[model samples]
Target: MPVTWRDLLDIFLVALLLYTLYRLMVGTRALNLVRGVLVYLLVWFIASLLGLSTLSWLLGNAATLGAFALIVVFQPELRAFLERLGRGQRFSSGPLALEELLLGLSRLSEKRRGALIALERRTPLGEYAVSGEILDARLSARLLETLFYPGTPLHDGGAILRGERLFAAGCVFPISESQIGLGTRHRAALGLSEVSDALVIVVSEETGAIRVAEGGRLSPPLSLEALRERLKGVARA
Candidate 1:
């Protein structure tokens, strides 16, 4: 059989669509579901090709049932994907002024000054913000350090940053229910990440270690350089 231009075009379109879907699933629990679906599909194809009639029949019927099951299972991911498509822009796009933020975090870590900072993405944190004093100041390292300084009025709670502005400070965030023996700052960061598509940075008051929380997972203690790279990656994404 000879290949034609139409065949090439059809293949290209399918590849593009798959790529888009993969991007949508990245950094999400839906990615694991996608992997399971692919494995099932491969098994079904092999059973059909090998003339395993019974196995093929079962797999075919399962696929038909799985379509509805998948819709119910992936409802949240589907909604998020559709929302992203409707937005036509990256959810976390914002001012890339990370130099100051990173500098302040590094200083806080060196001083063993505990700090929790959450960067708002597609999901709004207004409810969390209202729990404490609202600063609404420009994002700056000096201001950040001052806010989190020990014995300061706003030093006990988390800070919320939206775009290039500091939206609030001393905000009480939800505590994570994870079994891990994390401090208050880390627990709060993890909790926020679990519910929203926000990136959280935490500095330990006792250990002077830095950690990042995203998508309900926390990275190990990171160096200043590693933290900078991670923040940049989040910004680019």
Candidate 2:
């Protein structure tokens, strides 16, 4: 039995769909269910190929029941997935967000306040955000400065930006062991950029310098205008 083009097309479509599902489910507990589903699918295919009519019929019926069970058991995850799918399209961060960010960073640098901010892009940073306080507050220069002020509760931890909002504050990020002779804040920024597509900003308390980390590399100290251009480039990318 030679494989036909229809068979090839069928395999390609199924593989593509499974891959998409896996991407969405990654880093979630629901990932285990995805693996189970793959195994079930493989077993069903085998049963059907071997002419096991009774087994195939049982599996086919089981799938219907399993669908309902899955919806009930994974309701929260399913809802989240659907919401993410709905928001799959992204508009630019826009000039307003950029203006707020620049003002925030400029103020923080001028005050020599230590701050770590991760600007999220393609990768989901929910796990990291969970380690901190959820803000979901409007992004503003004064708010950013206030959050990182000395002795504040939100100070001394990373902040996360999701689109135009300061999604979380006091977030903890992984420290990069690879970056030597750097302070904890810079290392953490590097660590996060290495793992995700986020653009991380760091403010130096010692020298009031502003820098950014992306793709695991830290940039030279940037002036406010340069920072604006850098952000614009990232937005365009």
Candidate 3:
């Protein structure tokens, strides 16, 4: 049947939604493979439209074969995407509960105590927990303070937050081998970002400045209040 205006509009809307999904999936390694597959499919589509039966049949078979390969090759990306469905909005973690964290970090900063708080995003951080002791405690200012207190049992490693729950504690994050002089907190922040989309809030023991790292980038030094607001925005995005 010939396409009408309403049919064209429907196709455009569907294409737009698919394109948006494609953009969301573009950051990871699987994007290149997906693009290649799309190109092949496009070629086949054009060939079929033009009535090139032989080329179309070959391309169709190639697509069928590629579909199976894609299922295997893109498993990681597929899992990540599926996990994000609950989040609804892309890269947003909903609203963060930050009052307790803000107060806790403020006091720590006043005392010039260093701390690393890693907020979990889509990626599961269970593997990283193998490096240190795991404490599944409720999220609270006092617990965070106790963990980071000088000479405390879990002071040395990062704290992981999954939703409003403290998923794990004393988690030793992998340090980057970069020759640049980033200390444990900075390296830990970057390391977590590399592995997951988690936001890392770092309070410097030396300078008592607060900073947040996400998407492998660190924001400028912020006060305790500014840091809280920034984190809330990140979660709300």
Candidate 4:
């Protein structure tokens, strides 16, 4: 049979759909579920091909049930994906503003002041705002420094940045369950990164070192210049 332009279009559409699904599944627990589904599908295909009707039937029914189970288990990821899809623009920091933030972090690191700052990206972190004192003030380097200064009321907890605004302070973040032997601030940063696509910055009070947490992983201690470059990348994203 000769393939027409319409057939090419159909194939392209299917390939695009599969690629989208793969991209969505990456770096998520759903990826594991997808692998399991693929394995099941391969097994089912082999059973049917070898004339094992009973095995094929059982696998087919299990696959059908598993689809619903996945929906329930991955509800959060699904919701987040839909939310991102509906958003008008991808949230990112401006280069100049990010530089200012890095400047603030540099001073904090120099002073050996501990800090945890989570920059909200696609995920709405309003739920966490209620747990802290909501400032809703414009973001500035001085304000960031003051927020983390020693002997201050809000110095102990994390700060949440929504866009160019400092949305909340004294915000309590979840502690990471990972076996990474880190301080409270680092653990909190990791925890926030694990749950949302937020960029978390942590300053070590003891070592005056800076760390970045993203995608449930923590970066090694970063220098001021390295931190600025990292923030620039986030802003561009």
User: Against the hidden reference, what TM-scores do the models get?
Assistant: 0.64, 0.63, 0.63, 0.78
Clash pairs (backbone) in predicted model 2: none
Per-residue lDDT of 1-237 in model 1, one digit per residue for the tens?
999999999999999999987766676667788899889999999998999999999999989999999999667556656655553322242444577888889889889999999988776677789998888888888998999999998999999988778889999987777736988899999877765677898999999999989877899999888877787787777
lDDT of 3 by residue, 1-67 (tens): 9989999999999999888776555544445667787788789899999999999999888778878
lDDT of 4 at 17: 87
Identify the leading candidate in terms of TM-score.
4
lDDT of model 3, residue 70: 83
Task: For candidate 1, report its TM-score.
Answer: 0.64
lDDT of 2 by residue, 1-237 (tens): 999999999999999998887666664546778889989999999999999999999999999999999999777566656655654322257888889889989988988999999988766778889999999898999999999999999899999988888899999987776678999999999877665657899999999999998766789999999988888987886
CA lDDT of every candidate = 0.82, 0.84, 0.73, 0.82
Instruction: At residue 183, give the lDDT of candidate 1.
Output: 85
Tell how far residue 9 is off in model 2, in angstroms: 14
lDDT of 4 by residue, 51-112 (tens): 99999999889888988998997676666566545552334677666777888998888989
Candidate 2 Cα outliers beyond 4 Å, as residue runs = 1-91
Off by over 4 Å in 1: 1-96
Query: lDDT score of model 4?
Result: 0.82
